[model samples]
Target: MDVNKTYKGVALQEVLTLLQQHENTSKVIAGGTDLIIQLRECKVTPQVLIDVSSLEEIKGIEIIENRVSIGAATTFTQLVNSPFLNNGLEGLKEAAKSVGSPQIRNIATVGGNICNASPAADIIPPLLVLDSELYISDINKSRTISLEKFLIDKGQVDLKTNELLCHIQFNNIKNNQGLGFSKLGLRKSLAIARISVAVWVEVEENTYKQVRIATGACSKLGVREREVEALLLGKPVEEKTMQLGAEALKTQLEKRLAGRKGMEYKREAIQGVFKEALTKATYLSKT
Candidate 1:
């Protein structure tokens, strides 16, 4: 909590060197929305802060081949306004828009959101449904891993002490595919999500050729509802099928949150959220 050393205007190489040298004692700061709060509460007290807010290596969005690559420091506002996201990635755009408020969106970076690893993070469910992959680097080396595999638990991730998340990339949805997102919160704006769901579907001849469903706030980490996805894959797209898939998700949540407080509410709430997400994706695919 006490003031110490701060490094700024440094390049990526310098940041990595400082991180490698200080290891656990040095913390990276960007946006500072979550880290500032943690520091204020004395949850983390690093002796050195390496500010990566302006690092060029992690600050833009690019389209390479069939994948959309987003820099780690790209803010939520940038995501919401990007024309590229309109091309079948509306779910991600909506998720970025749903975070806190205009001010928060302007400052909160996608990397910060992912690195925070909060179970209720709005962007995680959408990213999971996108089948996103994360790139991580350190002074010594770099690696890539699936977003799902990178998240280990609440407030924790697979990142090493000296590693930094560089960017995220996911393949674009094909012409026959669509994505959707739904969130349940106490209010329409500036409300933390109580339960949220995202759906991605690939349709062929009016049937579900592939289905992916991810949920947030209902588990220790945002996760894919594999049982629900399994139930819907290869099934005809219809109201009845969607209802059944929603029920499958409800059952899965029951098992995942057994004995926890608010379990019943989550089980019941997931039904509507899942249905909404599926309906949106189905509609978009047909259009």
Candidate 2:
């Protein structure tokens, strides 16, 4: 609300130039759904805002060879309707649909969600299970980093003062691989997730060839549950295996959230959430 300047950015290079000029004083805004609220609350008072909502370079979803690229400016509405995100990637669609309301989804950008780095970010768990990567650019050069590494902490990331996140990239899901997501919130809509889980698995018959699990609102950041994933990988795809994985997750959460009051509830709730996601993932893998 009290910015020295605001630019309606039309080009990626131009946005980078503005960022370089303003340095740490500039904030990159795409879809201002979150930033505007932060501005109003005085949570952030940037001297300049570079709006990239209309930048063509960061506004669509495309496939280049075996990789899928999602522009940072792509809205949740776009993700919900993308033809390329069908079949095994239904988890992403579900996540996108769960974010805010219809109006909020229309303007909120996936890039904005990632950049905002909220602990309860609805879109992150699915992306994490897919092993997504980020493409970052600045005035001088460009670089790519894994989404896992890019996230440093709650409300923190590896981005530099002058860098812009251009797009997210990931390998195309295969017929044998599927991704699923489930979340528990206070209400069905417009409620931040208390617990969210995403499961990605590669299955052949009754065996799991590979497995990846990610959770949101269970820690400082949305993160992969490698220990639980390891417990499920190479194991039989059965109730016993799922139960074991769930127990492993609870044990890990017990340690991670030892002193928190939500620990007991989350440790128990994760079982059902993990089961629902894994059930959907298993069903998709066979289809």
Q: Against the true structure, whose TM-score is highest?
A: 2
Candidate 2 segments exceeding 4 Å error: none
TM-score of 1: 0.97
lDDT of 2 by residue, 94-184 (tens): 9999998999999999999998999899999999999999999999999999999999999999999899999999998999899999999
Weakest ten-residue segment in model 1 by summed lDDT: 1-10
How far is 191's C-alpha from truth in model 1 (Å)?
A: 1.0
Clashing pairs in 2: none
TM-scores of the candidates in the order shown: 0.97, 0.98
Task: Report the Cα lDDT for candidate 1.
Answer: 0.90
Model 2, global lDDT: 0.93
Give candidate 1 misplaced runs (Cα > 4 Å).
none
